[model samples]
Target: MAGQDDERGHDERGQDDERGEGDERGQGASAPATWRRFARERVAQRRFAARQLAELRGYAGRGLVAGTVAVHLVAGLAPVAFMLGTGLALRDLGSDAAIGWLALAAGAFLVQQLVAPVQLVLSRRVQRRVDAACIERLATFSLRGASLAGLERPEVADRLSQADEAFEQWTLTPGAAVEGALALTARYTQLVGSLVVLTWAAGPWAALAGALVAIIARLGQTEAFHRWGDVIRSLAPLRRRANYVRELATGTRAAKEIRTLGLVDWLDDRYVAENRAVLDTLWTRRRAVYGAPFVAYTVAALIGSVIGLLVVARADVDVAAVSVAVQALILCGRFGVIFPESDVKLVYGRGAWQALLELEDIARRTGPEPAAAAPGARLTPQRSVRLDDVRFGYTTDRAVLDGLDLDLPVGTSTALIGVNGAGKTTLVKLLTGMYTPQSGAVRIDGEDLRTLDVDAWQAAFAITFQDYLRYELPLRENVAMAAIAHRDDDEGIRAELERVGLGSLLAELPDGLDTPLTRALPGGRDLSGGQWQRLALARALFAVRHGASVLVLDEPTAQLDARGEAEFYDTFLELTRGVTSLVISHRFSTVRRADRIVVLDGGRVTEAGTHDELVATGGQYARMFDVQARRFADEAGAGSPDEPDDPFDHSAAAGAGATGGAR
Candidate 1:
């Protein structure tokens, strides 16, 4: 069952090879219950981000925006005051003061015309300042100490995306809030100024009737807008599905496979299915939310207009007085919708801001700091690495490395050969401090590994993993990353590149050392599988050149050709002359020359000895070699030894060490 799972995973990896690799950028979806929990936990963050808006104003320092808001309020009131002043001037004009009437109308219009653009530009500038401050603060706070893995989590990704959108929302809301407040304020300011003028011209009853209409209309719109906000929140599942469809279609990594596998039609259908699901839900909810408010607002507006006309008829008001009063009522009606829309925007903005705050909290707890390489000389073994009965498992039911005790003496290369499921890679990870042993200790120089700083402990070794990273970077960077701290060591880097047979490859590149080494990028070409393997070897060799003491090569040259494999081993043996090494490979021919060969089966060392001694003993190693070599012997007997088609070519093996399967 475990073998089947391993094979399945390998196949999946092969299929995923079509994916384009890069710095990933996209959001993921959260489970419904997870989103609910996130919302609850993030309440504090929302409160904090809300406080940031005020902090943003403070950053602007009250000098420009603070006085600007005050001026806006004064300017907003001027229109209403001027309208009343006009009516008063008209009354004076009818009583034979034409100059006073004309002066009043001209002055009021002039003030409004001048203040409008000044207030508009100031408000626009303030919104920009506030929005920029929020985005910068959120970005700094979220990225302060975030881990590489945290960037992959669905909730964190979603929050990051929401935070970006929230900045845009904040921009709109600040402008709306300022404008809405001005609108609401102007309504009242006009009412007071108009009431004073009407008291002289008409009566207190007409003034009171006008005030009632403005308040009632605004109340109706506020209720409608809140209902709309609630409706959108209820459709989050459909919204998330729609977003996932977009990601599948548009993500760079998913694109190649999606096209090659003929999944375009299937994915397009899925996108339409999800889009329809969202739109249907939205349409159904939109009617209920928007219908009631539309009816209520219409009723309120009609009522307000009716009352205004009755007041005008009973007062028998002059045409100018009637005109000003009607305009005030119309302005008040527009304020009702504007105020509620601003409130709805604020709610959504708060939700997004809270999500950002939650991400910051997660980042604080889980993010790892980038470790700086500590200066050290070519690692000469102060002491050997010791494993005192270490136990490990990736999951609870299956133990990959169990109570395994092993020791590599200082300045010796030990080859660990194992069956397919024998946990060689896991053992390598445990030795390197990438993972902690469950039951025992992996120590160096009598220091407990856990007690040493993780970064410092990891620096003690350099390894070539079976699953090596194929970095889409320059040829020099790809090789030099193994010793990244040696930024200026051009001579050392060139020497290692030459040692690994990549010197010619680098020279052939258009820009030499600076040329990019990936087809994914502009002005770059991809290397063949064997060439890439050599590049990987060069990377490990670069690490050795830069003073790596313990070299762990796990199935490192599985992709190399026969001659390349022989050359790699020869180069490796030379490079690790003074260092301790652990070489784990399935290739038994390669292991025959090691000082010691340890055969592991089911996480236990079943056989350990020199290759010649193990062959003499005729144990697991000897039997496996017989099974493979027997096939070659049978084929040799069937074919002529002198012919070009000869089955056995011992000459090539002699020239470039025997290279073939040990699996």
Candidate 2:
């Protein structure tokens, strides 16, 4: 147990090291250098705050921003105006002029009261506009990448997670930052106004002293909040884990598994433990960062207030002068103390804005750049889609596809057979240009795939992977998503659905093509697994109908039974007759019907031939086929002898053991 604790400590320290921190004890940088870094950070923070404020102003429109600013300015300066008016009123207490001064003071008070609600309403309007704009921009940035390769990177995922947490969990949105900036501006304006009033009522020396005190108190509070923000950011990983645990407990998708596995208590315990760890660390860090500073600022502020009041009391000043000086001093002290509305928003919302900027930077760096050729360049393949000695991997430690070469001839069907980890899916990704090979090339009709327009090239192929997404949308939208340009053609969509054997399912829906496919919505109904598979097939077929000549099916019928699988494969082969098709399936029964079969092993094609020819040679393909054949034979023999079943029947063995030789 001690060893485990030590290992955990080492791992945490390693993480801190990556963050460029010394250790948990905070014993790294020299004091002067640390102060310099802090100064630099403060400057950068101000610049980011300015940028966010400008963005908010743009999103909120000039009229709303101006109204909000006007409200806040009036509210901020009203106290100073009232103090001046009250002092004048006290100067001439018995005269009619004193009544006029009192009226001015009362008017200032009334104006402030009336504008307070206006400020709230305008600020909310600005926040809503900015929030909507930021969310829209985030969505756009997320989809800006042309290829899926960059999105697959771990760093991109981390940034995305941080961006999500910034918007959702922390509530430190760009909108909040803008509102905070506006409020903070008003606060500083009031502070300065109070000091100016002091200078007029007392003397310049007295006012200077008050300003120094306020600045010192504010600086300490700023440093404390900065440290607090750091602690919050460092705890993001823990918070994310807690969020995931909470989702598992509450979400419907994981409900069955959690109950069946009896993991409800375990999940609750995990969630509690993670949150407890986060709260405990937060409290510890809060005390360390805020305790001394808070005490010092309180003491300093008390001393300044007491000294200023004593000086005023000792002076031989008039009632009016004394009143104004005392009120101004109190106002200055109030402004010096930290305001949660502005300080918390500025500190945390700055971090949120920074996260968003980092996402934009990632988008710009990883998104596809313009190709040398026109982006509209069309791909009309005459020969084949080929991989030439391609070498690639998600990481440098091992290549998933190394020095591999294969070709899919146009207008011909090729079946790929391989073990589970033999790079079959990776090959399909390479062929579709979802990933680029580290060393070699993917060529279309002898032209390097990189030299062609990537978007146009990708749009030419219609692919259905093993794990197809089940969109909980209307049937028409779901099928038409593959060929959105032709979405208005409801008749064409219906025809494609009927072709994929979903005609009965379509006819059963009360809303026909408009019915949603998920039970989550009212009047919506979910389909069976086989029906969903057929819908996916229909989606791909819709793409093929609209100029997609290359059809790639990766375990497209994994959810179907033996007879259903056989029937679907036959229909698929017929529907995709003239298209270039690449079929990836574990079932040898379905693969035997392909025009050519390729056996992949050790990241390269080891055998390729007609099924009968490969069987005659007794290679890997032959061996896999024999294994399935024997499994089916055993199953046939186990049945009643009077049944007299044929083991080789495609429908009977279509759903044979998936791991027969593909283990």
Which candidate tops TM-score?
A: 2
Backbone clashes, candidate 2: 0
Q: In model 1, where is the ten-residue run with the lowest total lDDT?
A: 18-27
> Which candidate tops lDDT?
2
lDDT against the true structure, each candidate: 0.65, 0.77
Instruction: Give residue 242's error in model 2 in angstroms.
Output: 1.6
- Once model 2 is optimally superposed onto the true structure by TM-score, how far is the C-alpha of residue 52 displaced, in angstroms? 5.8
**Model 2 lDDT, full chain set:** 0.77
Q: Where does candidate 1 stray beyond 4 Å?
A: 1-381, 386-442, 459-463, 485-488, 519-522, 547-554, 579-584, 589-663
Candidate 1 vs. truth: CA RMSD?
11.8
lDDT of 1 by residue, 429-464 (tens): 777765667788887766666666555666667788
Q: Candidate 1 overall Cα lDDT vs. reference? A: 0.65
TM-score of each: 0.62, 0.88
